[model samples]
Target: MWISTSFFMMLHIPLRTETTSLMSSGKTLRKGVRKMKREILYPELTTLYGDGGNMLLLKQCCNDAVFRETGLEEVPWFVSEDVDFICIGSMSEPKQLLVREKLKPYKERIRELIEKGTVFLVTGNAMELFGQYIEDRKERMEMLGIFDYHAQRNLDKRLNYIVLAQYEKLPVVGVKSQFSQIHGLDNHHFLKMVKGLGDNEGSEFEGIHYRNFFGTYCLGPLLVYNPQFTKHLLELCGQKGEIVFEKELEEAYYERLRKYRHPDSPVVLGHGFI
Candidate 1:
């Protein structure tokens, strides 16, 4: 019942450009349109588990988004300039601590931005960097404390599962592979799990949501797996554009959903890593 990250990456759909409308406040973008500025934080470390595809798909959807791959040593674009969207993807457990240390100084800035409704997409364990602390058997590391939650890590075992969750009527489907489970997340959940373990083994809610910030442990190109959710995300970014290969993406989504929802599907609990 286990699926490799490459299984999601090898969609085999041909990429093609389509005309898209990027609108905000009843205004349509025209010639010389100001491009949407986006930042991918620390791509060198955060691009784990094929998460790089999330930004690629996002760029294709936005059409004219100016993307900055911010390195670990460079200052983040969101710190000084107005950025339309910021994304941080999955990384190794050790890298999470490094990222936390790098962003610790900007904790207040990040909180202000989150409160201001800046769009943020944090996937996989990268979301843990925003929590109060991360604890494993060996040691405890303080995180950004942007949120009130904490995470417990068990390096000996990995939790892997196919998730089917709902975020505002949209069926979100993705895979979660992590060595940690979040704790102390209250009502600020991003998705309600329909058929998967969430936050932790005992919780039915998944991810963290505050204003426009979306943090989830799910990985393997989340934006690509859930086209509906991606469209919703773009709308939050002040974009209502046609997704490249939209038809193909939707078809694939339905197929995956159907299989997961099937009564005899092996991906259900007791079969897949729950």
Candidate 2:
């Protein structure tokens, strides 16, 4: 089932039998274990950094709730036939260029899938290329334009911890690190913001939201520290039923959050890439 508020969208997916059995078994299963719902990570041309942790957390969350998680790499690879969610992680400028080159050939298909209401959670620089254009130091490159907004490198870099106010009744918290500014769209409403948009871009323009796509600048493996937001994303991916918080998983999330609460927190930089 799908649930939506003015600023946020939620999807609830029913648990499958195989997934429940695996969780109940208490066995150490490999990464790619049960298969039911489809979840893809665009890893071919992107440097995910801590986004892998985000995906893992989501998988574990689903497992706790008795739902299956599958990852898709190449286009031709098997994708569980029914994709519930598609997540793209943060990428460096060079890696993004390479991924875009590979994706250029499949632009039409990608656009079609996005328009079909496929749940997409894009973070950091990965979202820049999904828009009209990205302005880098060297030159300006055309993007997928799936979103109406445009991204341009800002003269100053924005790096700080944020406390986003509740939007549509869901609490959101994430860090922001970007040298880019988004413009050209006014109709679309942002989820919410409680901190910096760099040079004070404006209130209603902190983030981007259109259809089932959600783009944000939150860096440090966002979903891991934000279970409420993660659960909301899963709901958008067709997750149906009660959102029962798993004790172990919830503890793990809070532990990580405590480590990364402050901007100067040691956990912030130790994770390699942000």
Q: Local distance difference test, per candidate?
A: 0.81, 0.56
Question: Candidate 2 lDDT (Cα, whole model)?
Answer: 0.56
Best lDDT goes to which candidate?
A: 1
lDDT of 1 by residue, 6-94 (tens): 54455432222222324312446578877788888988888777787787777656756666778889888888978888999999987
lDDT per residue, candidate 2, 167-262, as tens digits? 467655555656677776565554555443521365444556677777776655666556667777777865554333444335655555454455
How many Å off is the CA of 116 in candidate 1?
0.7
**Model 1, runs deviating above 4 Å:** 1-33, 268-274
Backbone clashes, candidate 1: 0
Worst 10 residues of 1 by lDDT: 12-21
User: Which stretches of candidate 2 lie above 4 Å from their native place?
Assistant: 1-35, 44-49, 64-73, 76-82, 154-158, 161-163, 198-200, 240-274
In model 2, the worst 10-residue window by lDDT is 1-10
